[model samples]
Target: MNLSEQHRDRTDIPNADWESHMRRLRPILDLLKEKDRTLGEWYLKGETAQEALQHRAYDGKAPAKTAIEALSKEYGRKNKDDPKTVGIWNGIRSDQIGASLSLEIDGGEIFPKSLEISLNEKNERRGSRLGDYRSVAEVLSEVVRTYDSFYVTYGPFFYYTNKVFDDRPGVSWMLYLPHVLTSSEVPEARALIPVTRDGKQQGTIIVSVTDEVFDVNNRTHVKAANDIEIRLADQDLLPRYIDL
Candidate 1:
């Protein structure tokens, strides 16, 4: 039959009507208390599931001081070292949502032999001359560690990158920030290059923390580091993910 006729006929047939069809399937959506084994263990054992979840959710603002006491009642203190408990704790940490930067640095110079000469039989030679060197290497390294410490307190750090894409852009690193902050607040990434006594390239080097470019799911991960590259086209790059 025609489309309209087919629809009309189906409605007329009560058993075939959409309402009746849905009614038969409504029980599937009912909120039944399925025995969630995970929850059961926590509740029955009087474990710290609720407290742990709360702490993780609120960044350890209020911890469950009595969780171990309650959990010990059922699982006992020995079982507190159980893998299941550890897994639960890790899961809580993973669920903590926050933003962070992947900071990295590179560049700097390496020197080989400084001066090698022999004074014999009325022969004299001069040593190697000093070259231009960036004086900010030590200061920059300290800055990177400082920023890294600040972020680690809030969440875990991750590194990522792709060599193929990076070659075209030359040597570069990035710092990713969370959406909670604005780009203007985070300046362009920068570092002071160090010069070695031996002849070697010396300048502000870009260091990257992201070793692997692809994610576990094989998807290309993007970060604020990429944005920093875009923002700072050709200026004296400053630290990108700084608070000030």
Candidate 2:
């Protein structure tokens, strides 16, 4: 096997398919690591990343508070010691869905917040608050957590069955980090890059294109939304999934 084609030992998917995926995905990975500057994976900031949609409320002339938000608030007050729940999302970068919709990302897997502590924070001790870092940092953290929990048990990908909108199952790939910058326009996927640990590569970085890249001028609004997205790791990736 070549360098890019070395990590396909999964029994879940065919080795040939993994090889093909790696071959096509290598350049994208390099660009992500070099130019794109991605933090792989993201956790869901939704009110209930682990649970389904519950109660929801609205603010006047605007989208009201959601059940997840309410629950999060309670957790902040009473459950301070309890690590907040979070999850990662994967969505198709399509214009069909308006930016206002919360259900944009078609698929995701919810996990506990404690995993973040075990993977990296304990090892490197990147003393940064979730609010302070850019979008990529949180996304990268999620990628590692996902790999540790799901990939170790299953493989690089899994069969994601959407609970609500689309009941049909889709093959979901893990370790793909999206290179995202904040913006007002909806985000779109540009490519997927490989994720590495130590000297070897592990996951894929997702390169996303937003209507506008976050900069000083555009960041206020973008960052606010990112603050929310950071709380609820729900961001979109490329529109590709196997109809398994």
Which predicted model would earn the best lDDT? 2
Per-residue error at 65 for model 2, in Å? Answer: 31
- Which digits, one per residue and each the tens of the lDDT, describe model 2 over residues 1-244? 0000101122343322312322332332332234222222222334453432233222222222453355455455533333233322212122221011111110122321112211111211222212222334334434353332222100111112211123211111112323333323233323334445675655444322223222222334234333332322444322222311
Backbone-clash count (model 2): 27
Q: Model 2 off-target regions past 4 Å? A: 1-138, 141-189, 210-244
lDDT at position 184, candidate 1: 47
At residue 30, candidate 2 shows an lDDT of 34
TM-scores, all candidates, are: 0.17, 0.22
* Pairs of colliding residues, candidate 1: 104-207, 105-206, 105-207, 106-205, 106-206, 106-207, 107-205, 111-198, 159-210, 160-210
Q: Measured by TM-score, how close is model 1 to the native structure? A: 0.17
lDDT of 1 by residue, 21-133 (tens): 22221221121112111111111111364554432211122223344334334344333223222112222122221111111111111211010011111110111011011
Q: In candidate 2, residue 50 scores what lDDT? A: 48
Q: lDDT (CA) for every model shown? A: 0.23, 0.27
